[model samples]
Target: MKKVFLLILVISTLAVASQLEIFSSSGEWAFFENPARLLSMNKQGVMGSYQVFSGEGESLGTFLVGLFQTPAPNIAGVLYLKRSTLTESSYRTTIEYDAAFSPEESLNVGAGVSFTMDQEERKEIDLHGGVSGYLFKDVGFGVSVRDFTLWSQKGTYMGGTYLLKLFYDSSRKNRFSYSLVFDQEVLENRIDFTIGSEQKAGLGVSVLSNTKTKENTVKISLGFYATVNNVSVGFGTFIISSPVSSDPFSEYYYTQGTGIKFAVRW
Candidate 1:
């Protein structure tokens, strides 16, 4: 009887640890990040970004390269290659292809696919789609389906995830933008909300507040972006509180992360 009890306890411990692992390895991008913004593309170029996090004398990093193409007038496509690494032994690489179309002046639609692979030879493919439209002159709304079709290496089909976002921009002034975003991950049964804003000059300020299913905790992030002579750069930092756990060996606590991005366009 005691042995059976020990087995169950061990399993519980592992499960908690796994959850923490996923939490700690989240990407550096903001919760409000949406690739559908490319639907309004007016320029073509390449961009590269690198972000790093430091904690407990260890560092994790991500690097990305993006290519933008305008095959014809009013149509755009983006291809991305990204690599994320916690250590030499733990890493993931992904390739993504996305395209956008503007059927008229006020409506935009997009679709994408992402292929990801890890060190353990596990593979996943995620299908994505989205739509955005202007309600009035300056107010707009969008809905995105991420992982709409999830497939694994063994040809297994997983579930889907979705996100909804509403935004407003001052087209006349081109100086301010605000957004509300909600995300749902069906497989993990997790939901999150984010409210974000940006005030633009040659230098821009961006801020966001996010709340998830966790109890009594909220995550906040502050960021900045700047553009000069066709080159753009951005940086951000976030604060996250670890989920509650009773296990003594759990390395759960509050943590912080930072990210940086850069791009050049003609």
Candidate 2:
């Protein structure tokens, strides 16, 4: 019984620690991070992705389904559902809806709301908002807030997490971007740097630091994307650095895992 309890505790800790590191604001998943980016989509499309993270003895799987549409000349909206499961008895599901409005050609503002439910039927609601626009001819910036709880079965909180991102696009088809994320609730911060072409392939590196423990984790990703006749598909993989565990039972902490992603839009 003691060993079973310890195993559950370890898995829960790993899931929480890895949650922030798995998703990216670049590529097809941009709307997942900043809803304001949906304004850039000109056509209505549906997309989905499945990802798995695995370690020595356990694995976690995530599935996502989303769609975006332009309702008016300058208004766009997206709706998505995400599910994460560690075991049949342990899972979480979230549904999110976001909309962006462009008042001018170069500027957009957006807001989103999400509802989440866990295996135990605990429910939570979160609000998000963002702004994105061009600063220079080919330079742009985005700012967003995530996870401001409107209500929760556990409790209610204010102060959502924050993200700031900047990007530069060259006429030659290359784009470079940097993002910084601050999450006060967990006392952790993350930085992501990516270089890629909107036409083909890209590479990215991310560093996540725990302010309280002063420990840092590094992750690397590579992906390729293609577009044909208004349809787009993308594939990517990532690997994370492992953390050394001091636990007497476990040799290596499960914080490190490899994952792959696939997404398509039409």
Candidate 3:
């Protein structure tokens, strides 16, 4: 049918609008928080992170402004901005706003909107919602969904994504934690899995693998941080390796990058 053909064409044209692989903020576990984590009043702050792709030729930068304390005890909000550049020819920018609510200690829910623009002047909008909560003793689960629409001169393209995360908190008072995250890019039929562990004393590690790609690329990330005068400073690095590519004309098979972040409460 005409509708089926249009849908397929739209998905193919907007596949390039997929999420970017940027370094997490402060710690590798930050990726788990980016999509759905609710904000607590005690944790409001401003932070910025920058990362390079493949050690060169690509880079991403992000800034977060959070409002954790308000007249209402159950509401919080955040603003996120991100920019990325690839090989000097392609660039993208994203801006999003999220509002979160906690009805009780065991439940959290949020909704957000995001807008993105690329080098070709194409634009896309995303409407997302998420839910997360502690299910059992020290164990938690989260789920998030995103509906995206791309506006082009030819027609409009629609896509969707969903993510699931499971985490364990060993000590609620800033101790040790571990989590597993899975992301599904529904429209594109791609999936990513990640595992990460962190310590409040400022050390963490993470690993990510893509299931739908033949390139066999794996990303490993490490991070450490410390606090001084109520300010937190973090340093992190990422390494990407792929064993299947050897041709000189192929993309970089091995790449390493470093990033740093600083945050303070006010």
Candidate 4:
């Protein structure tokens, strides 16, 4: 089988890391790659992250540094880096950053760039943008477009992703919240969906999946701002065998990342 660049080691790393969300699966982190809600705490913050992914019982390790902020009460920014290894074989590294603005406390717009390396060679760049807010009490929606590379989306690669979320918070103070995110490739693959709920002190749950193939991945996440007075943590697993099994012929393999997170605020 001819080695497809998409299956290269660097690409697999991005795939597993896909589970992390760095924020949420639902697009709450839409302003950037993390999620819309992740930006909910737009104030300046930082965190440490780690993730492990197992494909066909092969375990890979990933370590990360994540940080974000709201330059102003309505402005936000985020930065992160991931160092990964597959069985102690140095695989890939990624660096990314995003900045945004919230107008009238109901809208947000942002963009981001990611630099990925495999064998220390530039591998991929991810770009994104989204806006979110409520139409009425307990009702909100968010839409996002990601400038993904062709390999990430397939040959039809529009190089984009779109996400929409509907949520209702028991508390309206932006203190506690929950939302359902339906994200799709915009023009590729299946419908990728996510369901998540979160609270003020720092804790949450999420389930991500594919619509057509019936493949499902579930994850449990927690954030404790208390380290900087809060804590952040997360875990997740995906059912890759159901529809599209791991490429047994996959020579150019790549892996993604996800895991525990710790951050401090100044």
TM-score of each: 0.67, 0.77, 0.65, 0.61
Backbone clashes, candidate 4: 40
Models sorted by TM-score, best on top: 2, 1, 3, 4
lDDT computed for candidate 4? 0.48
Q: What are the per-residue Cα lDDT tens digits for candidate 2 across 1-266?
A: 65455334433433433322323554445666787877767777665666566566566677676777887888888888888777444887999999989888889888999999988899989999999888988898999998788898966464567888887777526667787776652232333333444546666776656555666777666665656555455556666586433221121234444433333343
**What is the per-residue lDDT of model 1 for residues 18-130, given as tens digits with 9 covering 90 to 100?**
11111110122221134454655456666556555544554556667676766777677888888777744477788888887888888877788999887888998888777
lDDT of 3 by residue, 1-266 (tens): 65445334433433322212322322322422543454443355554555544533434333233323333667666666766666555666777777777877789787878888877877777777778778887777767765444343325555445556565655443334444444331111222222333223333444444444533455555555655543555566656554222311112333665655544554
Instruction: Flag regions of model 4 displaced more than 4 Å.
Output: 1-38, 88-90, 150-161, 173-258
Predicted structure 3: lDDT: 0.49
Residue 50 of model 4: what lDDT? 54
Q: Extract clashing residue pairs from model 2.
A: none
TM-score of 3: 0.65
Angstrom error of the Cα, residue 264, model 4: value is 0.9
lDDT of each model, Cα atoms only? 0.51, 0.65, 0.49, 0.48
Stronger candidate by TM-score (3 vs 4): 3
Output the TM-score of candidate 1.
0.67
Q: Candidate 4's residue-wise lDDT over 51-146, tens digit each?
A: 666554466666666667766776767788877667647577778777767665676666677776765464666676677777776656666665
* Deviation from truth (RMSD, Å), model 2: 10.0
RMSD of each: 14.2, 10.0, 12.6, 10.4
Give the 10-residue window scoring lowest on summed lDDT in candidate 1.
18-27
Best by TM-score: 2
Task: Give me the overall lDDT of model 1.
Answer: 0.51
